[model samples]
Target chain A: MSLQHALLGVLEARPMSGYDLVQFFDSSTAWIWAAPQSQIYPTLRRMERAGLITGDDEPRGPKLTRTVYSVTDQGREELERWLSTPHDPSPPRDPFLVQALNFDTIDAEKAHAVLEQFITEQEKAAAEAEAHRQRLLNKDTMLLKERLTRRDPAEHDRIARLKAHVFAGVAAVARTRAEWAREGQRLLTED
Target chain B: MSLQHALLGVLEARPMSGYDLVQFFDSSTAWIWAAPQSQIYPTLRRMERAGLITGDDEPRGPKLTRTVYSVTDQGREELERWLSTPHDPSPPRDPFLVQALNFDTIDAEKAHAVLEQFITEQEKAAAEAEAHRQRLLNKDTMLLKERLTRRDPAEHDRIARLKAHVFAGVAAVARTRAEWAREGQRLLTED
Candidate 1:
């Protein structure tokens, strides 16, 4: 599915081992679209079987071989097609919001506690997103560093600006959630 | 599952037929948690078998018997437990943001078009959410009306405030997304 396209998009940048891709996903794309390490190996195998990607074996140590994955031209075409297509927005499914909708079922104290906990969690998430944004802005991230090393100078700027914008978007969402939680807390406590 | 809990929570308010529950979900809870009519009947059967809810048969017409479902005492306890428990925040999975992260793979014009389309969609969503919030604020919703009729006068304000807070929270999220989309469009268009 989209994970396959995501893998193709990442490999389109440069050849990477399955381990490197997992690291990349964790460091960069975890906030937007996460795929566990357990899913990565099986997906890589499936993509290879489908001819979207190719795996080349390389010797890592004595009696050990590692497979490095790279996207084929067909994969690049598929990535482009997916990028151009419009995607339906995912349906909202916030459990905290669901709880808020049914707040009458619980006492005010319990509701206030939930909002407080949500605020704390949201603030922590916003801080992490801000840190990640700063890294992308400075081009200090491994993903961006790799792109800068391999791509044209102009393309590097495009990539950095787009990626930084995505991180900023993430940070904004986290901040909004925190603000909403604070408002809920105030409503629960105020006269 | 959360859907089961959601059904129980709504039934705790008042008894509802399966058809009525589907309408309720479509009008109110769809913003937070969505379940299709197809899944609703099957889940209801399972819940009844499990003794979480009870359905009383009533004559609808000459030949049809409608079942009105209400949460049992066990269902009420289950709902209270769920309401008191803290839920983990859902991980983000925005496909637009995912495509934005890989913007270098696509042409600049295509990227700009995508961002523009996103902005339009987000603005529409924000407007819808704002309308919903206004309805909650004005106490014009059927759900709120029912609660006002049944609950104590003192509890009415608390319920309205909490539910309105949830709707406001939804509005805020939509506005944030629209803002993010606008920013993305600007980034795409800037020199």
Candidate 2:
């Protein structure tokens, strides 16, 4: 599964405790591939059982121990194989679009309100994505900087450019969503 | 839960056999909310148990009968409530973007090829969405025509506009994806 590969990829960046991985996902990978903390612990156990990752107990404080995860050699090979493989686009699952398809059941006023709210939410998302794009471009984000330091100097430019490309893609999607919502609002108001 | 509501909405249009619903989902709703044929039968049974839908056996031949499903009053009321509720945006689960984030692990040429393939797929999808939008605008799609005939004449215009809005939204998303892919391709090529 892609989640397994994603976990391997993240662990390959640096050894992280489950708590740290959850924080990393929330702060960075949430925009790309989100996984809830509830799912993380179970998945980590599975990955360990499958020999893709190994967990070692480390002292956290006077009496506390935490399990820190790191990718195995097998995991690195698997992550690379996944990276080389072509990706299939995911199935459509947009609920707002589903509602719009059944618009005959709702009033025009309610439809307009929904469109407006969608536009507002999309605008906020676009702003956040744009800010993220700027952070990637500046090479100031923590994940980007850490990845840069870990890789060969020859890879520095490619890594920075590719990551920024992903954020730019996210911003474009948000802008298009906002644009579509505005168009829907206009259609509701006109005629 | 959204899938349940989507099923109810489709049934509100007209009674359909499970087979017909599978065909409908494949032809029409696949672009908005895809449901597998495997899930359809089980979900239909669950809905029957919940009293959200009623199934009546109709003779198809001398010895064979088919169950046709239609929305109950409770189903319609539930659908209306769902339509009135605000929707939260689904989290991103794009694997290609995840790969991009870990670009340091992949060779540049492979990344370029992947971006090119993605662009081609998105361009094809955008064209199909555009064609669907045109059909909705002309009120020529079978589903749109069916809903129009069943609803009040005064509601016809609103229904058409709303449906077209959904397709337009689809078109915008596809176009944005294509654009992002193109940008990714360029990033891979330059420097």
Candidate 3:
């Protein structure tokens, strides 16, 4: 995702300090996207310089001061323009799969260990996705469900069903991969 | 995925010219990973220089000669070593999602138009994935299924089921996403 657009999104919602925006990302969108504090701070300054956001000076103790940012009308317009434009395809790069396919060159035991490590990492991801889904469910899911329940029965039901499907699919894949790794490790040990 | 690893994968299966490696990528792994011809050719030359693969001089047309690549024993060993290593997380960075997040800043109609274009592209992907799945179903899938069917009903069934799940999951997700896009288009139009 474009850092600029994401910056504009939070700003458009409400004026916030760079720190606040960083917190917002951590809490709200960290599941699907993540940005380091380093990246957030630099982008905030750059956006202010570009006139996309205006920063209000807020004094700190002695040396360091914070700047609260609000999206400029131009920034909002730029975001809108971007939204209307055709999207370019992202460059394909997946290092993990690369490692998987190259396994034949390495020791079988090592390949098995790597797969085990991958399973561990995926478990963490699955946990994070679960937490994010729960937060979303808490915030908006009930309201959406109520609205859908009252509306077009079939369409609403389908959409309601799909939200469940997406979550289940992600969880199921993670669990299955973990199982495969465990079995692979066991079989490797036997060998 | 790393182009270096992908090249080795094709070589491990059988020796191939740089041209043939490119063709293999297009036919098989292009869905999960892709490397441009520009990147592939340069990498092949580098791999040869690094002693990863040896280039066989084969006669082409009148003037040009083809260089076929075979993985060196060292290269095979290197690939094996890599497989045993833990997979590094490669975070997804999608520009389109960035645009969507800031969509409120743009003209709603234009934003919807962009989504419409994406739907068209997704439809194309759905078709391609369906064809691929069908091809696999006819060949490798049947072999897998036969193995599953003839094996010990309890012991062999679990692994067979898991593998089937992976293949089916990919196909289902693609089909569902395409349907979601179509429905989303209608929602945008109505709005």
Q: Count the backbone clashes (under 3 Å) in each candidate.
A: 0, 0, 7
Which model, 2 or 3, shows the larger TM-score? 2
DockQ of each: 0.68, 0.69, 0.24
Across residues A14-103, which tens digit of lDDT does each residue of candidate 1 receive? 789999999989877888788889999999999999888999999999999999999887887888988987787777766777787777
Off by over 4 Å in 2: none
Instruction: Estimate, for each residue in B1-191, the C-alpha lDDT of model 3 and write its tens digit.
Output: 36787677667757788898787777666655688778888999998899989999998999999988998988887666566668567663556655544443455577667767766775666566566555444535433444445445554434433333333434454455445445444544442
Residue pairs with backbone atoms closer than 3 Å in model 2 (clashes): none
Residue lDDT tens for model 3, A133-185: 45444435433444344456545433443333334334444555566556545
Interface RMSD of each: 1.6, 1.7, 6.6
Summing lDDT over every window of 10 consecutive residues in candidate 1 chain B, give the lowest-scoring window.
Answer: B182-191
Question: lDDT tens digits, residues B54-156, model 2?
Answer: 9999999999999999999898888888887778878878887777777657786887777777778788777877888888888888777877788888867
Given candidate 3, what's the lDDT at residue B25? Answer: 75
Can you tell me which runs of candidate 3 are displaced by over 4 Å? A16-28, A37-46, A86-91, A98-123, A140-191, B99-120, B136-170, B179-191
Error of 2 at B80 (Å): 1.0
